[model samples]
Target chain A: MNDKVRNSLFYVGGTAVGFVSGFFGGGGGMLCVPLLQFGGLDAKRAHASALLVILPICIISAAIYIKNGYFDVTAVLCACIGVVLGGIVGATALDKLNGTAVSIIFALLMIAIGIKSVIA
Target chain B: MTPQHVIIIVSALGGVIGGMGMGGGTLLIPLLTLAAGLEQHLAQAINLIAFVPMSVVALVIHKNNGYVSIAKSAPIVGCAAIGAVCGSFLARYAGGYELRASFGAFLIALGLIQMYKAISAVVKKKKASKNKSAQIKVG
Candidate 1:
């Protein structure tokens, strides 16, 4: 796809994905990775983009959740710390690993989880 | 027809699905691979990015309604962040095609399982009601 087309699609798809993530708690990044990839982004780049993009969404959601009494400050803090650490580590690893292998494993895990969710 | 068109269509589609309480990853990832012709990793990454805003909105809504359950959400979010980072690193070394294929299979499997569970729950409920009715008649 041309740049213009791709860009537009990205925004549109992004909005939709955002909506879904908001409703289901699946985390929006999962959807972002695949869409960015299709939009011609490398895996690493896409991952980075996804992380950057999610920050705002997550924060907004957290705030709302907090306001409505759905957020546990303790949990959010702990989780944020863990995620920050993990994200740093992950970013470092991104340079060394095989993207395809990771994708396959990830996909398989998704399927397993999906199936379990469906069946159980 | 073009990638741009796909993006717009997909994004909007995702929003509606999200609004309806369905997970966007389920739909977005599939389209990214099949229609957009993206590697799984890229698609997933993109999905992640796109999901941020909507999730924030939802989270806020849930919090407003007092549905957050901070204690429970914390662990999950923490774990997920860690997992996401790990997954991101793995994406770097893995072949894009392989990643897409694997992720796709995983998702399909998961969806199937969830569907099965839902079905079973319904069926069980029916069976239980039937048994109860039978007992009532006997009495």
Candidate 2:
């Protein structure tokens, strides 16, 4: 696709992704990765770019949540600490690994989580 | 486990998933709601807040590994930020039940798509290998 068309699509798709991420409090990456890949990025770049795309959206949504008194400082702090550590490990692993297996496992997990969320 | 322990463990798991390019919020919100006994909205909130830092960490690492494309991602970031603000307000207005149901549905749909993509990729790889072997035999 032409650069103009691709840029427009990304902007539009990004809006949708942001909306979903904000509305649901998460899951933007699921959409963002595929959208980026569709726009011509490789899987690894798509994933990484998805993370960058999500950062701003998360901040915006979290701000809204905080304004509504939904903030949990303690939980957020603890989670941040753990996530930082895990992020290091996972990202490091991503460099050396073939993502196909991991992608499959992740997809299956998402399916299970989706079912459980709806039913339970 | 203690509440503190649970928090740490869940966050770590979320970080790992996020680092892998799957949004951790999907896993984190459910875990907090069902396992930690947090109110649904509150759990979601926590997930969003935690995601900020986690994503930053993951992004940095990905960048270091030469996986990020700034020119490609900038426009999406701008638009997504606007959408996120709107979505957050919408979630607040929609109430918990509606929000949860929508999230559930979204997850199910995405999960199915991912599965199809993975399967197709596997099949394609197998066929390509088979073709290569056949060509070698003919030669």
Candidate 3:
């Protein structure tokens, strides 16, 4: 794509991604990954770059949630600590696992909970 | 195990996935609601908040690993911010029940797509290996 076309695409796609991320309070990166790939990044770079987009959007969304009277210091702290440690581990082991297997498992769990979420 | 412990464990699991480049919030939000009994909005907020620090750290790792491309990402930020503001406000008004149901629908769609991709990838890999073995036998 030409620079102008790509830029416009990014702008429009970004808006949709942000809306999904913000409204759902998560899942923006999934949209972002493909969007980045469209912008010419490889899969790994697209995933990483998606994080760049998600990070700031999440910050903004989180702030709005706080301002709207949703604040839980204890939950945030516990989750942060766990996430950081787990992030380090996962990042360290990124190249070792069978990615397909992991994703399949994740998808199954997501589908199961998704059904329950809709029902309950 | 207490709720806090469950929160930590699930967060860690989510983080590990997030660190691997998938969005962890997809898993974390539902897990929080189910395991910790948090309301959907609150759980979403927690996922958003918890994501920040971990994202920062993961970004650094990705950048160091040469997996970050700023040029492709920068153009999207401004529009995304505007979209984020609009979406957040909408969520604040929509209440948790409606949002939760919609989120479930979204998850179902995404999970189905991802599962298809992963399964296809596995099948392709197996085919490739089978082709290689056949070539070896022929030679």
Candidate 4:
């Protein structure tokens, strides 16, 4: 896609994603990745882009939840601490791992989640 | 074709669904991938990107409404966030076929789980009412 088309799509897609993230506790990347791929992005690039877009959305949702009294500060803080540390660790792991293998493993995990969701 | 038009439509949809407590990622990813024809990883990436802003907004709303249990949610969110990073990096080198297949399977599983939860909730509610009426009659 051309820059103009891509940018436009990103904004449009971004807005929609933002709304979903706000409503659902889960992130919107599940949809975003596929859509981006459809728009001609590779899977890896799409993943990076999705994260970039979600960063702001996550912030907005967190803010809304906090304002509405849905957030437990202590819990949020603790979770943030863990998230930050885990991000670091995961990033380091990624540095040494093969991308395809990691993705396959992740895919396996997603399959499990999918199965569990269905079974439950 | 217009950015503004696309933005308005998607953001509005996202906000309404999100406000209603539906899982945004669930809806958005499908729409992006199935409807729009994006690759799976791209869909995930876009979903995450959009989530950042939406999440900030939602955090505020949830915080005010007291739906956020910091104590319980903290661990889950923390772990998931870290997991997300790990997951993202893993995707970087993964083959397209493996990713798509796995993602599709995951979606099916998630859908099933949601269906089960819905069914169970209804059942539990019915059972509780039945028990309550029985006790009342006995009394």
Judged by lDDT, which candidate is best? Answer: 3
Model 3 per-residue lDDT at A111? 88
The better-scoring model by TM-score among 2 and 4 is 2
- Highest-scoring model, TM-score: 3
lDDT per residue for candidate 2 within A18-69, as digits (tens), equals 9988888888888888898987799779988888888888888888988988
User: What would the DockQ be for model 1?
Assistant: 0.05
Query: What TM-score goes with each of the models?
Result: 0.52, 0.88, 0.92, 0.47
Docking band of candidate 1? incorrect
Tens-digit lDDT string for candidate 3 (B116-136) = 999898889999999999999
Candidate 3 lDDT for residue B48: 92
Instruction: List the lowest-lDDT window of 10 residues for candidate 2 chain A.
Output: A86-95
The predicted structure with the larger lDDT, 2 or 3, is: 3
The count of residue-pair clashes in candidate 2 stands at 0
Per-residue alpha-carbon lDDT of model 1 for B1-139, expressed as tens digits?
7665565555555454444333444566555556555544445445544555555555565556554443322322443344334344434556655545554555686455545655676679899999999999999
* lDDT of all predictions: 0.49, 0.81, 0.86, 0.47
TM-score for chain A as predicted in candidate 4: 0.70
**Chain B vs. true chain B: TM-score for each candidate?**
0.82, 0.84, 0.88, 0.71
Q: Would you give me the overall lDDT of model 2?
A: 0.81
Query: What DockQ do you compute for every candidate structure?
Result: 0.05, 0.69, 0.75, 0.05
What DockQ score does model 2 reach against the true complex?
Answer: 0.69
Q: How do the residues B1-139 of candidate 2 rate in per-residue lDDT, one tens digit apiece?
A: 8886787887788778766656766888877766666777777788888777666766777899999988778867888888988988888777676676678788788878888998999999999999999999999
